[model samples]
Target chain A: MIEVRLFATLRQGREKSIMLDSKDFSTPGDILKHLDIIPGEVSILLVNGFHKTLDEKLEDGDVVALFPPVGGG
Target chain B: MERRYERNIPALSDQECRLLRSKRVAVIGCGGIGGYLIELLARIGVGYIRTVDGDVFEESNFNRQLLSEQPLMGRPKAKAAEARVQRINPRIEVEPVSAYLDKNTAAEIVSGCDLVLDGLDNIAARRILAAACSEAGVPYIHGAISGWVAQVGISMPGDGLIDILYPQGVSFRDRSVLSFAPSLCASVQAALAVKMLIGRPVETGTIYYFDLLNQEFETIRLDLGKKE
Candidate 1:
């Protein structure tokens, strides 16, 4: 299963988490495409505590989190 | 002779002032709070400043950003801040880089600095900076402002301070709403940075919060051992 999470404004507009079967997806880009999340809308992506770029592949049961850039100071 | 920092000069001797003049500081973000911090540090004669920001001045920045204005809109914030600081005090050295603070560049940028200052808008960047500081063994002053409240803290190496203070993660909000917040927090941060640079004693690994609405301030000791 692929578990996707959202934080901050992204969470406001979408469900915090989404679950998908591992055999149904190949990479994070594919999962994002399936979710219909527009590319570049979210700035940072973390896969299991490590920052990931757009092209990085996903693994089974991986926890992926997305965050939109929000100003704090 | 050129003008000196009258207040800080008297409090800290000439030798200490020279010491401050020889140190390097890197301020990440270059927004409302970062702008104020850059101005203060340059005015007081910090020898080297490395300013980082991947953002440009926008129409919304005019409300509180010291370096933001109608003419400067659409320009790189780091470059504009560097120009403004140079004009304020040409004696100090300023290097402004227009780029995001990521893992690749964080270590190189923060490695030589005596200290790092948080002026970033997002928690992710703060976490990245915190991690870089931890790796580099450099001291970092953290500040965040939201609406009418502001918070400041100093993190030392091996302290695990950021993880303790913001365990769940910091909330990411719109920049415009945090205008007054950064100024208030940056003012205190600038003072603390100067104190740290001059070898003065200051509260470390502790969080300080201020509420502008009620005009009250409070300090809290964090127990980073417990994480959520």
Candidate 2:
């Protein structure tokens, strides 16, 4: 199973988190695709608390968090 | 200090408050965060403040830039910030430099200052300031805001936190910051700078992510490896 967490405004319109079967997705990109989240909407991704590209593979039980761009001021 | 800082006790010892009277702090950017930081530092008795900004106020800045007022629009940001300091405390010295801070001039702008506070609006400019601070061995306080989200971090030489967080050439586009966000983050920046001035040790390379919309906060550790 892979755990996906969302933060900030992203969490506002979606569930705080979701768990998926590893067989359903092989990478963070795939998980976003499966969740119907547009790739362009995310600005950063942390796989188990470190920066990682969306194409990086996700192992069973990996934790993936996504955040949208939030630059201002 | 003076009898003015009597009420600052408990939060600050008399010695600490007095020490603040002898320190100088450089504020890069006289917009929302810089304006508030300059005011806060002045009120807290920081002896000297160097405010840097070349841009004048525009009507659109009224929504979030604290120093921007109807009458002050079209005036230079550093000038308005200096006026704010004067109105708040006649005793504090404010050196307002009405110019854009870039790689070529960052060092000279911040020279002789104990610390540099970044109230800049964009990432590329921040990178330039950070490099300058690192070269000079002065601590740099950073704050950024977007909507209800804000991040504050300290960059000491090797952290390289800014570069890790904002890649080169990437910047905020059409992003909007609610009025309160920059204000809150500015307060945080001022507090941290004060803490550093008072001889308190500060941790660098970690960001405090604040979500005011949901009233939540998180810490993100940034270890982009040591700087070259």
Candidate 3:
């Protein structure tokens, strides 16, 4: 299982915490795709506490976090 | 000029005050966040400040912009910020550039700065400023607001956090910032800048998230030091 955390509006109006079957997803991008997160909706991606690309492969027990651009004045 | 900082004693030691006094900061906007940031730096005895803003105050800004007083609606924000800084601390050196910052002008505007602060409302402008700072090898302090939510970060040379913070074509609309957002963000930005200047290491490459509604704060660390 993998832990997924969402920040700000990236929560998708749902619970902040998510767990996914690790075997089904090979990368954070795969988890996002499984969840149907819109492309470009996530501005920052962290897996196990550091920025990683969506294409970076994820292993079991990997913790993924997503953040959207909160840019404003 | 030094006497004004007398009261800041133990909070900022004489040496620290002297360090701040010798440093110069460039503020890239003079709307809500920039206004408060300018005032904070002035009061804290930062000797020199360079402010830039191409916009004139609109009545709409009255809701959140600290410099948008009813009487100064038509005035350029840069000029207004200069005037306000003068009134607040006459001894401080303030250069107000009443123009917009683009790739062409960023070099000229950001010259002779110890650090640059971003008060831009949109992602595109911030990207431009970030690239300029990176090219100059100066640290860039970034703060942005969306309603009661705000994000602050520090990006020194080679961080490339701006590209991560603002992905391609992320167009942030204006008029979403509440009065509290910029004020809060400015305060955070100023504090971090002071920390950076005084030789205290800032958590560079980290983004601080402030949620005013729930009053919760979290940090997103960008640098891992090793691949996961």
Measured by lDDT, the strongest candidate is 3
Q: Is the docking of candidate 2 incorrect, acceptable, medium or high quality?
A: acceptable
Superior by TM-score: candidate 1 or candidate 3:
3
Spell out the clash pairs found in candidate 2. Answer: A73-B121
Candidate 1 chain B weakest ten by summed lDDT: B167-176
Q: Write one digit per residue (lDDT tens) for candidate 2, span A1-73.
A: 9999887877766788988999989998898888787765565577888777768888998999876655566
The 0-to-1 C-alpha lDDT of every candidate, in the order given, reads: 0.77, 0.83, 0.84
Candidate 1 residues A1-22, lDDT tens each?
A: 9898765445555686888897
| Cα RMSDs, all models | 10.2, 2.7, 2.1
- Write down the C-alpha DockQ for each prediction: 0.14, 0.42, 0.59
Give the candidate number with the greatest DockQ.
3
True contacts kept of 1: 0.34
- Over B1-228, each residue of candidate 1 has an lDDT whose tens digit, in order, gives 245566665666878778878999999989878998998888777889999999999988777788898888899999998898888877788889899999888998787899999998777777889999989999999987766667788998767766654435344444445567777888899999999998889998577767565576656555444332
Candidate 1 Cα RMSD after full superposition onto the native fold (Å) = 10.2
lDDT of 3 by residue, B1-228 (tens): 267788988888889999998999999999878888888888898889998999999988887888889889798999999998899888789999999999999988888899999888778888889888978889989998886788899988657788878768554433377788898999999999999988987788799988776676878888633333
- Where model 3 places Cα greater than 4 Å from the true spot, the runs are B1-3, B169-175, B224-228
| DockQ (0 to 1) for model 1 | 0.14
How would the docking of model 3 be graded? medium
